[model samples]
Target: MSDAAWPAPPQGSCTLPASVEAEVAILGAGIHGAALARELTLRGVTCALVDKGEVGGGTSQWSSQLLHGGIRYMLTGDIRQMREGLAERATWARIAPRRCRWEAFWMPHRYWAEGLAHRVGIGLYDHWGAERPGWPAGLSLGHVPKEAFLADPRGVLGPFRGATAYADLMTWDRELTRDLAASSEAMLLDFHEPEGFEQGDGGLKLLHLRDRRDGSARQLRARRWVFALGPWTDGAMAQWFGETRKRLRLSSGIHLWFDAVPGCERPWAIRRPKGRILFVVPRDGLLQVGTTEREVEDGWVPILEAEREELFGALEANLPSLPWREMLVWAEELGVRPLVAATGATTHLSREAVLERHARIPNLTLVLGGKLTTARALMDRLATDLTGLRCEASTTAPLRLWDGQAAEIR
Candidate 1:
């Protein structure tokens, strides 16, 4: 039915969705869309979130699992992005203690000179957190042992140098994803993949959905549509002429899990000789590890044994005392980071605000690369601009996620 002929549902109340109506139809039920769902519902907007698979089943679950400040981001001096992210980090920590909790991350420095540079950088972190509520202060470590992390063999060792501790939060992405799905009255359909759709009347967006579970198909119409589809968003915008897949550059990252790592529960960051930054994150009960950033062409590879092999070697070389062979077998997972790049920028681009309306889809908005800490802020901006009905976003402050307390919000 044409939008004008179809009966319109009341703005504040949901009427059955016509087996397909939504005030806001957000694509991809991962963190990006999930968080947006929560905020929209809190604002009383009727939202329908659709995912090809499970909610939070995407890379959101496979993240480095850090709700960390932009320490790496700070390296580029993206002040506006850093400050805003710190705020969101604090908020996520406050609300979601179950799945999101604060933990201290250590980056042990070997060279005295490099230590000095890190000290200055950490000082900036401390200063940044001083104005914010949830961030913790960076602590300086004196001399330590080679096997200090013997408790967690997957951790950094050697050089007997001091370590610095900075504040960061980690969360169970899946639990948080589930929490968001539960918190919203918004209809979230899993495995109901979008087949495609034509632009609707009056700038409305329509989607042809296939309920993969039952092999049933239907069309969904919405006043506004959101493409928070993570990495796949690059291809989903194909129907539009003006939009280019170049709008986003996908990055591949890998992580290994092992409980064998010896050390304090405090997470630590280690600088590899290759100018790469790696983290040995302590999550829930598993020792999670990861992350080399490399650009991608147009393919999705599940797990790369090469990445695991190289990363394992790196960890073993850095910490000789650990049983790398034994610990490496614990568990390994992989995923891609949906990175949005602006003109003349790369994935290493500044950790800044990436809220932009789709150049081609007038009724659609796209949220690009952002820190786990900044997702909420991104949601707030999205709601303010697209809701067409201006409502203040108190959410940027009220919701907290550290320790995964946000899971409880659901």
Candidate 2:
């Protein structure tokens, strides 16, 4: 499936024209940009969506691919974030059913006290999501049988108290992102890198771009401009705003994939040392074990040999029965995410998306730190706040992507 080809563009349209004009010009084509394009187009605005590479080919594709309600956020008492994610999760299940599906997730508890606490916590999560459509009821198993878990032959090291199973939506992250971009009525320009831009007379923004494949120059003009450059936010900001204090703290996360365990069909939530959360997700007949989170100075950090071993060691400590080293596949992915710069751990930083008008550039907005599950909601808020367009209440439900015949953001 990894080798599958992306859908070709419409017939007779292979390259971007030399010059284009629109009401709005988007500088990135990740999920955020795609969603914003869709939202803006729905509000009767014309947009030009451009990307340095293929849509969703950046950090958007490297997600864990779970449209979960962020159960880990409950630890920090962030019920608002969890509720917002849960609502968005339900929205995805309702609108993009072909691209997303509900999957059962299990979090095993070793000690009785921990098991009880998880039950209470997950119950709260269920309560918060209960009002949303397609929300699943939580199931607390007091004594999950060994057969119910994908335990190692050596047996789990800790005393088995039970497991809690909950529902979360899973998606083909890259495919969904591409579909959103394709569905947007805006002009889609893949492989077009923004070189630089200058403000023209009368508040028009002139953006200089180059076709990455042929190195052909192009000019795009628009009344409004948006920077949804994700991990590249720092670099683009530095180039445009000229060396302001760092606004983003970058973090690198890496995931490794392995052939599925014989009977393991559901995803597992394993608690690592130091209270970090790791997930073993099963998708497309492969089990993906990940992810190691570490703060980095920039977004170009590579996955080291020691990081792989660290992931395996954590898996062995938690689920020692599985063949941690032997079932490894040849593919691994690494992605960098930007968080608000602060003095605490990266995990503690708010995962909420940041949308702010550029201080130096007129009619320019900068977007940072959004997740796949909450992208639509974030963009809806952006549309309302930036464009003064009120989203019709009916458009919130039964959303459709580009794959459907009648695609609309509302």
Candidate 3:
């Protein structure tokens, strides 16, 4: 990795503020921070946003890339959450259709005993969206594992059994984040690391930031701070919220990639027999396969695994006939998902993210545990809280900065 993979803020942009008109500073340029920045900037709030790494390069890049409404919640039979999630999921399709669009996912229908409950679940899923007779509203691909493939030996689960097709959005999540950051009036200050903070009379004050590329240092001042740092949310919380920062449980997930089959169509979120969902997500050239969750105690950093046997094991379990013999055309990657754990079922953690205000500091707000598909709606909630502000977003079409694509902050 280039030591300078991330760029420096525009020279002289970080000048220490003598006194600011507004009182809000948002720290950490992950997805949530970028969403907040766009919302606040459009509201004309005075704010300074900072990040330790490249904007949208952290967990945002690691997302499963599903702009889902909440199929997971549907399985739980929660109408309210399912309804809310579907609404949020649609917002992405509307705003960033280029970066986020709709996809039809398949839930295997075999194993009648196990899937009996699931059939009711997806029927509710279709009903929640008011699914149309055939699809979009709700479509069912007729069941049946293909006799040829199943008889061939390598086939694992099958359409031969059948699957329920559900609608969800496939998103270029990382790119959407970069676009959101660009939507903000706040200066896009990337590559600067927060050094420390001090408990001052006015509130918590950021001491300084270090430039990772040049070894130079600078200072920036803001009235208040917001922590949207993904899993790093914990560290920022511990620092400003006293030693009493709320707890967050983090985990790592991995996905494998394969070239689209001879003519496999759009994205397909396949439900495996083991309660794990592997996304058969489609991109221009490749299909995204993956995701096995492993818990991590501290989550401020990215996960790196040169060889993930277990991650692949799950994929192999799902895609039984994958041809390792073909050679030269598959990829595997793993990243951490920062989820707030709740009791009941592991996947049933509150889909609705929680937001809390700092007891000591009135302006600082901490937004925790949100799904990628719900970001725009999260901003909508922020707008609702602003009171008296028009909720209409700007005419600017949403964009996502995949890889290192850069955009001008307006």
Candidate 4:
């Protein structure tokens, strides 16, 4: 495997002050951190949101960009997971309709059994999404005949009886994260790097931080601390706080972007013979094909040639007449998923969020293993845990994002 270096995260334009104090100080300005900060701010709590790089610069910026209802989780018969995702999907669609929209995903099936299974899955999916508060009515599965496939621009080569299409919401994950952070009353410290922390006299944590751009030291005092370090959670605890516990397993996912494939206006979900699913999504004039799931070590970002070839092979295998290998790649992205450490392969590991209080530090909370679709719900729970009061229904499900804008302090 050859190493293809990842582009450095963009330097944040925001600067830090000499010292800051907050009621709740959060580390890691990815989606979860941003979401939690927003949640607290909405509850009239002061928050300091700190990150080592620009906001949304971490794995939050790199995703398939689908607000899906855990379609793959259905394969494992995880109904609860599916329902949770669907509920959150509806919430997001309601709060940020301007930022996301419904899109149809078409999947081709080779055999009668395959088609039947897909039909059943779609039926279940539609049933779960029916009467969701803000989302549109559930859509029935649409079929595409083989004769229609012959005239398609994606150039399907193999013979197939038909295809099934269903609907899911597509979003700009990074932009949504930034909007949440910007709309929050939290003090966003984008380029602040945490060095260490110590206990204060009042049972608070005094966090040592350095400005990445100026190398100037600063301190933040807070009553509670939360680490939403994503893939860096386990190591950050060990390095900064000297706490050692197995908390997360890393899975690497890579996506390749090319100039929009002509006439491929919508996303396609394809299942290989071995049951590996691949997605081809077209967005913002580019076609993104991705996401290989393999166990990887933390802090690994280089794109391996094998990963590129694997994605290319999947596309080529599905659309043989298409020149997938010869096509020029406009860009590439690699993100590591922090899965809950388990005995099975990373592919089967849980995406459910885990909240752990530090063994010794009662006020320190560590968040692990959640996705873009479920971050708001996780943060809502975290907020409730920290505040010891249940959020009203209006504070959640009906709160409009990007509304009630907070003044910019960058």
Candidate 5:
């Protein structure tokens, strides 16, 4: 779909005013910043949300677009992350039903032992969200018949024990991010980059912003500031605050798109030799197969020939019968996910958001390591921590986006 099909910005303009003042200045217009703008504006706080590029034009557009409740995280005993994801999934379904729809995710197992573990893990996942209203029930785990499994003959590995199927929500991550930013009362400044900041009187932050279209500059002042730079968190911190100790460990992920697999409408979670999960999602008549996680020295990772070869090998190993070469190579996306720096493989990094308050800068906050699924909850927590305002009542209230579509939370 063309960009025109989605809702336009509420301000209908990205032109920066000469001077603007607000209660908060949010840097980075990705999903996190957009969601924070919505949450803050609803609480009667004026905000200025500035982005170096178009809103959601960065890594937000390159997400897997699954509103899943982190089913894989359950294996690691990350119950809090799983529960937050479940609640956020339901919230997105309520407010953006048109944008979200249910898809059955299949986890095929090659060994009985692995299948048993999968069944037990999925059972726990299903039970965790049982009390949440409007959630899907009756998730089943069973063996797949040989004939049924071979029906598609595309990317389906044979001699498997069985599969576990469960429902998860999917949406257009870019559109949702745009809608949240455009609909908020906050001033959305696209194509504006933050040059630096200066400490102001009464603990106010004076931000210097530059227009990317032209060389013009503007000044913005706010009581509090948030840096939601996503993968650029470390760079922004070093450039602006000059106090960076490597708070985030960046991992690069790549997704390749092809024409929809003939009969593979439902998404599949295929396990790789390294025990990592690769998702093959079908959406909008396109088949998206991805996500290889590897630590990166910087954020400028691209889709190299080795990555393409790896994907082709995966397809050949799993679904040897499918003519993968014949499928149209639609597009490719590369994104960097900020993970908490720790000793382990990049695949084992937690997906939780990290909120760091500057020791010297009292009113400044740095947001890092978050997922698109939990942006709203993360922002709510940040708002409460910064402003001491509670959003208990608004949790059940319908959230209206840029197009004036109300998402009923109840």
Candidate 6:
């Protein structure tokens, strides 16, 4: 889609005021900050959300775009996280059903042991779905014979014993982030960079900001603040807050796009040779094949040519019949996963958001490491911790994020 055709997000004045004041000041406009702004605004708290770039123009723009329940977490014995994700998934379905929908995921296995594991995992997932009250039931897992699987995609898939199909969600992650920020009453200041922080009188916090558009200095004073910088957490903390103890384990992920191949519209979650998972998702007339993971030193989102070849190899390994190289590459998306630092590999780091309250600074919360699927709950916790606002389940859970065609009305 052309930039002119895209819905313009709710933005405050381009000319930065000499000084601005708000109840809360958020330092990032990615999914985490956007969700936090929405949560605070919904509770009648005024907010100023400042970002160095456009809203959802960072990692949020380049997600795998699946609002799944984290069924894969079940394999790691993180049942609580899985259930939390599933509950949040159900809530997203309730509020913005038009933006997201359940889609079938085909898991093809070459061996009986692998196929049995998939079946058991999916069966447990279904049973767990039943535990969430008021949520829709999960679709039953269907065992597809090898012949039927090959026939449906016109024998495009490589050889496999059989496959199991189940359901999760597919969404427009970038649009969802934009919609949340737009739907809120927070002052959205894109292209504004936070230079540094200072303690003002009366326990107020001062943010030194430079308006990126004009290179003009601006001041924002707020009683509370949140640093939801995602992958930029480490660098931002060091430069702006001066407390960088390595808070994030950065994992770079890349996705390749191609023309929508006929009969391959169904999404696939195939296990790669090293136990990593790759998704084949069809969205907006393009097929997105992604996501390879490796630990990185910085937050630079790069689509390395080596990684491109790796994904191309993965796609070829799974769907050898598709003429991927001959076809034009529709697009390529890349992002860094901001996972909480841990002792293990980057892939094993926690996807949960960590709320770091500054010991020296009062009423400031730093958010690190979160996923798009669980942003709402993370911000809800942050809201409660920062404001003592009672999170009313009746009001928050069912709040409509967007109402069909009127989604951009705000």
Each prediction's whole-model lDDT (CA): 0.65, 0.75, 0.61, 0.77, 0.76, 0.76
Tens digits of lDDT, candidate 4, 86-127:
888888877766667787687777889988898889778867
Please list the residue runs of candidate 3 whose C-alpha ends up more than 4 Å from where it truly belongs after superposition. Answer: 1-22, 112-120, 130-160, 238-246, 300-307, 324-330, 341-348, 383-390, 394-410
- C-alpha root-mean-square deviation, candidate 2: 4.6
- lDDT of candidate model 1 versus the reference: 0.65
Model 1, 350-405: lDDT tens per residue?
54547777555678777776655677667767876776454454444343332444
Q: Please tell me which model should have the higher TM-score, number 1 or number 3.
A: 1
Best by TM-score: 4
TM-score of each candidate? Answer: 0.82, 0.89, 0.79, 0.90, 0.89, 0.89
Candidate 5 residue-wise lDDT, 334-355, digit = tens: 7778887788887888888889
> Candidates ranked by lDDT, best first?
4, 6, 5, 2, 1, 3
Which is superior by TM-score, 2 or 4?
4
Task: Candidate 6: count the clashes.
Answer: 0
RMSD of each: 6.9, 4.6, 5.1, 3.9, 4.6, 4.3
Per-residue lDDT of candidate 2, residues 1-410 (tens digit): 01121233323333657888988888888889988887887787899998877788778888888887898887888889999998888777776766776766777888778888887887887777664445445544233465665353323554444577666778888877876776578888777767877765544378888776666789998888888888778876777557567778887888988887766766777666644688888788788888888887665567888888888888887777677888757589887777877798887787888887766566888887878889888887887776788767414534345554335322
Q: lDDT by residue for model 3 over 1-410, one digit each (tens)? A: 12232445444433434233334567767777788777777777766667777778777877887766577665555667668767666556556655655555656544676456556776667566652212243333323235523443323443325455566666666678877887777765567776776567767665477766555676766656667776667756676454554456676677667666654454555565445576666576776667666566555333355335664565565555666325344765555556665554444456466776767766566777776766666765764575346556632335444434544221
TM-score winner, 1 or 4: 4
Off by over 4 Å in 1: 1-18, 131-157, 239-244, 273-275, 342-347, 351-353, 388-393, 396-410
Q: TM-score of the candidate numbered 6?
A: 0.89
Candidate 2 Cα misplacement greater than 4 A, ranges: 1-14, 131-147, 150-160, 200-204, 393-410
The local distance difference test score of model 2 is 0.75
